[model samples]
Structures are given as structure tokens and as C-alpha cells.
Target: MARSDIRRSAPSPRGGKSSKEQPRGWRLFFRRLFVWGFSLALIGVLSLAVAVGLAAQSLPSYASLKASQNEQMIVVRARDGTQIVSLGPSYGKWLPTAQIPQVMKDAILSTEDRRYYSHIGIDPVGVARSFYVRYQQGKFRQGGSTITQQLARTVFLNNSRTFGRKVREAVLALALEWKFSKDQILELYLNKVYFGGGAYGIDSASRKFFGHPGSSLSLPEAAIIAGLVKAPSHYAPTADADAAVGRAQVVLGLMVENGKVSADQARGVDLKGIKFAQEGGQNSVRYFTDWALPQLDLLLGENTKPIEVWTTLDLKLQNSAASAIKNNVPAGTQGALVSMDRDGAVLAMIGGTDYVTSNYNRAVNAVRQPGSAWKLFVYLAALEAGYTPATEVVDEPVTIQGWSPHNSGGGFAGKIDVRTAFAYSKNTVAAQLGNEVGFSSVASMARRFGITTPISTVPSMVLGSNEVRVIDMTRAFAAVSARGKSIEPYGISKVTTTDGEVLYTHEARSSVQLVPENVANGITDLLQSAVSIGTGQAAQIGRPVAGKTGTTTSNKDGWFLGFSSGITTGVWMGRDDSRPVAGLQGGHAPARAFAAYMKVAVSGRPVERFQTDMVAPAFQISPDDEASFSGSPDEYYYVDENGNLVEPPADKTAARRPSDAPEDPAPGPDDANRGGLEAVDPPPAASEDFLNKATGKEKSDGTPPN
Candidate 1:
């Protein structure tokens, strides 16, 4: 049984050859196998040929990937369409061979490619020498990449540290040599290489680090630039001056030893006082640019391809603003200034004290309590609610819905005219007005004026408990200064391509009417008083000006927002962590900065006054009063000379206060210094109709009013 099973499993054959002895079938099978093998090999070869052809066709674009590279950068212009800064695409600017100094050429040749003219892309001798040196060091140390190989790495090859990437770089370099002449390759290489300090290419580096173009580079500067090829950031003149100079000397010596430069030339070069542009006055503006760039992108779209944007930045104004902030603000304090034209174009913006240390724009990014600066919106709401600029408001402490707001001082002023309250920044008057005009309606009015911050109907909101950004606040108030027209603030004006083709244009959009002309005029008048005699007195600019001053709790934030006939500016000073700044107030730093900036921003420009009708707003008054309820002292009519309530023919003879209510006390002092008087909750006053109906009706006991 075992033998039969073994025989059955051992072997099987179709023909009588025991499966291994069929010579003719085996021969035919071998022939067919040979033909199939030949066909498969041929197909593989053809497929490889097609792939190579396709790669060759695409190789021209990346051929000189290592030769030279240049990146195009867009630039931005200040107001008047003057360039303020440039944005780099690849940190490169193309320069011809003739435009580069011989010293620079010799220095680079000695350091990078000694036999570049003779090599066929790969320098085998150099590679072998580098390999030998590396082997001796027992580690991967030296790189033997030719200038073309560098170009390939910088342009076509990824920066992965792998043998595959090196092989690909070599292949790309060979293709580059096949497609371009040596001089063209050199030209491109010089134009594309990075030399550090935000500079790309020899032309930009030559100017940035050496303060000269490539053609004007001295021997020392040329050597320094050539040496930077090893480590651009480390050897950058701006970063490590001593190290860079030492490295530059090494490059000079190498050039001499390589016969690229004479020893005399090396000895004659001096690198002393070789300062970088970033180490000089140009650094002053970097902070401002860093903060402004992202904002431009956000407003103009991410693909603002042109590196240059035409902004309304006035350098003189910016300088003045910065100087004023530095001088007036505390040592650790941060500040921002935003100035706009009447059309709402942001003429200048200074976002922080140091852009390099911080890109956070305290002006546009930080939202803090607006404090008394918010009274402008409050007054606007009152005016829209039929209260005149001259309306009478009791400046005494009064509580509503369990909230009590005090003026700056703890004492309460009794009665005051609206204009005087606003001019003096009396908190009680504004809070009372907020109560009189429904809080929700006032909030709606603020929203219409473009106050983007979410506002709650709490009583404290009348005092700017809501947080607001300087830019948004300025824009909102600028609408008031612009005669009731609300418009968005923008920095960029237009963007264009290098060929002068306009890629985008930012037109000032249509403005919304936030308040009526008369209401705006009244508020503008109050703001003028603020600059003339109120907390914003420091902002007076020797011309008719209008402005408001704001100081938040604990002096944590201070602001002075103002406008002239032509330009409006908002200044803010505070700490980043929302801590208190000692003795800081709107009248101190922010006002001073605003004034300083305006002096320069409006220099040589006409001095214009804000336009107003000079007419007082009409106010709603008691029916028994012959005089209107204007806040003027003469207009208040409690004792109408006859010991009777002034009225528009009301039946007041028989009327009396409820027996349970407390007596209405006479108004007291109007000075802002006496602000807090322990605000007491009072019963809701009757509506005008309800009061008219109850007037002259005595209680059943016929007692005098409580």
C-alpha cells in the first residue's frame, strides 16, 4: 500500500517520456519561452526608452536648476504711490555677468568651483578629493556640490538629506549643462543664490550687506558674500559681524592660494565697519512693516502676487508718531497709531513698539474697554432720541436696574447742560442719557455706526464696558467726523504687476448714514469742546479740531481719538497683558502722540475746521415749561418765578406726588469734580401721557406732594 501511494504521488506524465524525456516537446516549449522572453525584454526596453524621452523633454525647465536662480518679489508703495517695502518671491534678483565685480566672481570661483569652466557639470576630481577628506574625518563632512549642483539643490531638488536626493541633484545638474552655456549658467547662479538677512541673490545681498551693488563690491565684501554660501544666516554680516569678517578673510586667503586673486589684493582688503543695512536706520521701520504685511494680505486677498502695495503710509507721520510714543509712553508700554484720510484710507499705521520682538498689533488686534471715548456714541444716541446738544440732564448720581456709575470723582454734580457735561466728560450725564434713550436703541445706534464689538444692554455698557479695537473705534468715530457717513478703514490703495498692469484696485465703498446730519454736527461740536477745554485739550493742533479722550479702569488702557477737517487719527497706549500703566491717561500719551503725528502728517497741508451748522438741537421739554429743556441754566424751569411747575397748560393746580414717594430734591452743583452721591434707586417716572393725565390731580387727602 505504501509503494502504490508513493508511485501515485512521485511523478505523472502526459507523453511516454516520464515527464523529463520528451525532447521534441521540450524543444518546442524552450523555443516559445525564448520568444516570450525576448518580447518581454523588448517591451521593457521600449517602455524605458519612452520614459527617458519624456523625462528628457521635461528636463529643459530644470536643466540649469543649479546654475543660477532668481526669484521675483513684489513691493508695496506708500501714499502717493511710492514704494515702502518689497516682498521677495525667492530672495533673488537676476544680474548679468558684466554687472558683477571681477572680485566677486573670483572670490566665488575660488571658494565654490575652482574649475567650473572646465567641468562637465560633475567635478570628479573635486568629488574624489572631498570624499577622501570626508573618509579621513570618519564622518560625512564635506560636500563636493559644484555651483551647478547647488543650483539644482536650491531649485529643483528637495532638501531631504538622503542619497536619492543627491543622485537626483546630480542628474539635474547634468541636464542643466546639456541645455545651457557656462556663462548663462553662471549668470543664473549669481542671480538666484541666497546671501542671508532677507536677501536673495548676489544683487540683493550685495546691496543689503555691503551697501553696494554686485558690480561695486570691494574685495572684502566680495569675499564675504562668497563665504556666505556655506551658511548664509550664520555668516550674515548683520547677524555675526566678527564671525562674518573672519570668514571673509578666510575666503580671501583661499582666493589668493587658488590663484584667483593676487596675495597683494588679499592683503589690501579691509573689512572693518562693514555694517549691514538691518543694523542701521532701516531697522526702525521693520516693526511697522511686519505688522502691516499680514493686514494687507487679509484685506487684499492672499494672492496679492505683486510684492508691492500702494499704501497711504506717510513716513514723516509714522516717524513722528513713533517718536512721540517712545518718548511719552512708559518704558514697557506698547502703543499703536492709526491715521486715516477723510475718505477712510489709512494713511499710516504703527502697530507696536518692536515688530521683531512681537508681531501682535495692539492697535488692530487688541480689544480693550473704550472708557470715556465711548461717550461719543452715547451722545449720538441721545441726539437721535430727540435730546439736543443743549438739553438739560441731571448730573447727580442715579441708579437704574441695580447699577450705579460714578464720574471720575466721587462727588456728584446736580444739574448741567448737555454740552457742559460732554465737554467735562461727566459720567453721570452720559449714563443718564443711556437710560433715557433705551439702552437697546443706543446699542443699535452704536452698531449702525460700525461698532463691531458685541455690546450688551447692561448699564455699564454706557461707560464702554464693551471692548473695542483702536482701528475699529477710529473707523466708527471717523464716520461722525465725516458728516455721518460710515466707511471701512483700509491701508492698501492699489496693487499692480511689474508691467504696470493693475491686478487689483481697492475703491472706497459707499458709506452708510449712521446719524442724521444735525445729530452728527452736534456731536462734532461736543468733540471740538473736548479738544478745546476737556480732557483732550492736549490734542489741540492750533486749528479747529475735534476729539475725545478715553481712560479705562486702573489706567489699563488709554486712548485719544480725534479728527481734523482732512485727517482722523486714533492713538492707544497700554500694556499687552492688560495690566495697569502708572499715571497713564488719554490726555497724556495718546493725545500727545496724536498731536505729534498730526503736526507732521498735515504739514504743508491746509488747516481746515470741521464744518457745523452752529444750530442747537431741539429738545423735548415738560408741557408746563415755556422754556425748552435745553441744559442751559436759564432754560431749567422748576420754580418758574410763581412757585408753580412750568407747563404747556397742564392741570397742575390739583396734581400732587404720591404720598408714598420721596420728595424730589432741588438740583445741586454741576461741577464734574462732585460726581458720586450714592446713587439711589428711584421709582420709574410716568410717561409723558401718563404724567399729563395725572397732573393737577391731588390725593384724596388733599395733602401736598411727598
Candidate 2:
């Protein structure tokens, strides 16, 4: 067949064109392929658009994001509004983009996103380069997150490095870009980003790292802070100044490359002139703030607004107390002081000398034996048991159950009245009286006086063997100063919101009458004697003061608890590990500290004297008062004639009259009988003693006939 006929038979190769038009068949075939490919590409684009729109629906609304910007800071102040400390996730005032320094903005843009102004939430070219570089490195080495993307991640999304989280972050970034201006996005990012050391914003980071506001930051300072966006803690100037300086240099180099700063300008910057904020020792009231923070939450539940806590702490007194401890306390040993008013308002407290070294609140938390300070309760129990200040008790060595308590100086003072024994801190007399009144009675008496610590019923308890906190002891002593009304120590007087809404006001009132007025007056008289002429003589403040000195066994704890009509102060000095401080004693360092603190604490206060009634109560024995006189025979007795038993008159006044029995000779020094039991007035004469004398059955020795 002819060639033209063959081509025409093959559908004419392009509708009957010549062989020169054969190339058009191939073009037509390619054109149809391009049409199908274009349709598939459009369908794929539509599918991606649908998926992105669905994911964007799950993002937080713009209003919710705006509402979350109110981060409240808790500001704690003393009673006088002196700033003690401020605490929160972010601890400074928020700043707008206009308030931020231009240097900081330039540094951030150069180091983080150079195309921040030109991009719409994302830079495709930067992202592609970042991905290519990451793929070449075989690991995630760089991030392409723009500033807007970072703000979205910070304010709305979790910091998860996954494909899904990145996708969500990108979608949220676009949403933020659509809803807010670039300046608004930048402000949110600057305020919400975390800049280590518990600082969460540019303002906090600036003040924390530079000791100034963000508006005053210099070029290098801004560069250093901008470098922290990559790693805040690792590059924090407070922790490692060298690393932070290096990071700032890197940021400076980037700024130069991005044309934000010239190379000459960068070279003129001095990183050394940038003084990092001095770390530590800034807040002098951390101990007080630490204690008051928990109470803030307790008083105002779930507070979302800024709160102003008006604590009872006196900044002057607190500073003085801390200084007193720092200067007076030994180097190796630790000390704590708590000062409260008659109403149990804790005015000044120093839990430790340095809060930066340790935060343990020894004043509120340490429990140490009160030693002889506990004898106040014992003597109070004795007073309640019908024993008067003139009641005579032997101060010789005495044993109760298996425990024999000796004096601090290991020698008996012989026979002395209860007042003298207490003033001199006679351990033997205290133990004997504790035994006569019962140990449980003394413990109950302590509880009545607001000693909430656990009190054991052992005989040594009268010598302050039981452990107690300084705050508890201060409260108990304050009750005594308050004329026997119970008291509870408090630090926070009121808590209010920044808007003047009152949340709590302390209304402290006595829970119960801890001690009778008569008992309180009597105890006050004895304690006054303690401060005036006894072991607590060092605690005298020229005004009337009542206090007790306590030295624990082995000098493990030394305490001086005292109070005037105006204030109650307690001082404790000891090692934290319970190791005895060499040469430390209650009357030495602790009493000195107490006197030092009170000298300043009560300088301007009106001096008032304690009520003193020296007249002793008339003693009369009642047969129904068995518990008061339930001691053993060797513990009490009546005068005998020729070693024969005889009962005396019931009236104690008559029994005090001259005894008919021959007076014994003066006791010799070597005689163990020097401190022997003394005869006391007895009840009306009974037939049992008369019968013994009538039968001429004389007792051989002082021992009772069995």
C-alpha cells in the first residue's frame, strides 16, 4: 500500500496531517497526561486544606489566650508594708512591646528569627534549610520555630518534640498571627517564655539577672538575655557567668551577620561591664516568708489574683534578731529566737543565721528538752496542790522510782522554802515535789499552760526532760505574762487581695483559762525571783521580768524563756545535730541572747512591775485531802520525844510553835544526816502514836517502825 494510504489507515496520525505533523501526536499525548496530573495535584491540595482547617478548630480561642495572661504574684510584706519577698511563677511587672528596649528586640530578632517581620507565622525557606541541615546531621540539631510559633507553644501547647505537636504548633502559630498583630505576638512571647531560676518573663529575667527592668537593658545585656531563649538554666549568668558571656557573644555575632548591629559596634561592647545581679543574700526575710506562704494558701483557698499578705513580722526587730543571733551565736552552733507580744503575735523570728545555707525553721520546728525551764509547771502544780511559797522542802539528794536527779552543780542546798528552791533551780527539790504531787499532775499542768508538746510522766520530767518547741514555750510563757489566759502564737495578722478584698483577719482569743489568777500571780512572783536573783539574773532588763533558764543534760540544748508585761521572748542555742556546744549553758549564751534581744525589743515600751503578794496562805490539813499528802512515811513525819512517835496539832499555825522535844545538835559536815528529813506539823494526835509511847517501845533510829 502507498505511505499516505498507510498513514491515513492509522487514524491519519493527527487527523490526516502529513509525516511532519507526526510530532503533534506525541505533543497531544503529553498534553492529556499533563491535564490528568494537574487534576490530581489540585485534589491533593484541597485534601491538605481540609485537614489543616479541622486541626485549627481544636486550637484555643483568642479570648482564652488573652485571659490567661493574668499571672498573679504573691507579695509578702511586714506589718509596715516593707517588702519581704515576692513569689510566683513570674515575679515582676509585665511589660508591653513598646516598653521593651530596642536592643533586646534587635537581639531577639537576629538570634531567633531574622525574617520575623516578613513571614506570616512561618518562614518556608528557613524551615526547608533547617530540615535539610537536620536530615544531613541525622538528628534534631536546630529548630525553625519562629517567635510567633514559640509564643503559641508557650501559651497554648505543651513542649513535645513530635511530628503531631509540631504540626499543632504550626497551626496555632498561624491562628495567633491571624488574630493578633506582630507586636502583640512578640509581647506575649516575651512575657510568657521561661527564663530559668524560677523567672518566667523578660521582666523577671532582666531584674533577676541584671537587677533592673527590661526597658533599661543595654546591648550586651539584651544579647545575653536573648541567648537564654535557647537554654536559660544552662546559660544563666547567676549560675555560670562565663557560659552566659559566651552565649551572648554568639548572639552578638548573629546580630552582626543579620545587619542588626555593625561589627564595629559589636566590638565596642564590654561584656564585663554587664554586672550580673549579685546572687544570694538579697532577701533578708525569707524565713518569715517561707513560714507565711503556706498560711496564705490555707487562709485564701485557690487564689487566682495577686495577694498581699500582711504578716506580723517587724522588719526592724527581725533584722535585729537575726543580727543578734549572727553576732552572739557561736560559729559551729546554730541559734533561733522568737519574740511575741502578750497577744501571741510573733513580732520577730530568726530560724537560722543564714537562710541561704539552710531553710529549716528551728524556732517553729525544733523540739528540744526545756531542762529546768519545765520546773515552772512543776512548781505551778505544787501551788495548785495547796503548797505555799513558804512550804519547806529538803533540797538534798532525792530519788523517785529509779531516777535520782541532782543539782546542776552536784550539791544539795539543804532545807529551803519552795520559793528559794525554785529561784535557785534546785533539781532535787523539784523532783521531790514532783513525786509528792504525782508526775501525771505535772504533765497536765504543763498542758494547761499551753505546752502542747508530748510530756512524759517520768520523774525526770520536772527537770524538763520532755522535748518542746521554742514557739510552744514562748506561748506558754506569754500566757503567764497575760495573767493566765491561754494564747496561740500567730504571724499573719491579715491577708487581702490587691483589690482590697479582705480574706482573713486574725481574731486570736484565749481558748480557756489556763491558770487561775491566784496561781498565775504566785507563779509570776516565783519567776520574778528567778530573773531578779537566780539563774535568770542575766535576763533582767532593768524592768520587771519573769523567766526561767534551762540547760539540758550534756549541754545539748540551752534555752532562756522569759517575758515582761509587754513581750515574751525565747532564745535557743545549740547544734543542729544535737551535738553539745562546748561550754554552752542556758545562763551563759542563751540568757545573754535573750537579754540582748529584749533590750532592743522593749526599749520604748512602758515598764510595768509584776503583782507581788508575799503573804503566805494559811495551811490547814483536811482528811479528804489524801492525794495531797499521799507520800511515803520517809517523805514526811512528826516531831518525836526520845525517838517516840507523837501526833501534833491539826492547826499548822500551832504546830509551827516551839517543839517540846529536845533540840538536836548541829549536823556535822561528814554526817549524811546533815540533809536528813525535817519534822513537820501533823494532824490531831492519834491513839496509835500514844500507845507506842505508853508501852515504852522507843524507835531505835529515824527509820519508821514496820
Q: For all the candidates, what are their Cα RMSDs to the real structure?
A: 13.0, 12.1
TM-score of each: 0.77, 0.77
lDDT of 1 by residue, 91-183 (tens): 434568788788888888899999899997889998998889888997666688899888778776767989988877777677677767888
Model 2 lDDT per residue over 70-94, tens place: 4676767788987677677654666
Lowest-sum lDDT 10-residue window in model 1: 671-680
For model 2, the superposed segments whose C-alpha errors exceed 4 Å read 1-73, 135-139, 218-220, 256-268, 279-287, 304-308, 330-332, 352-358, 386-392, 496-502, 576-581, 613-706
| TM-score of model 1 (CA atoms) | 0.77
Judged by whole-model lDDT over C-alpha atoms, candidate 2 comes out at: 0.75
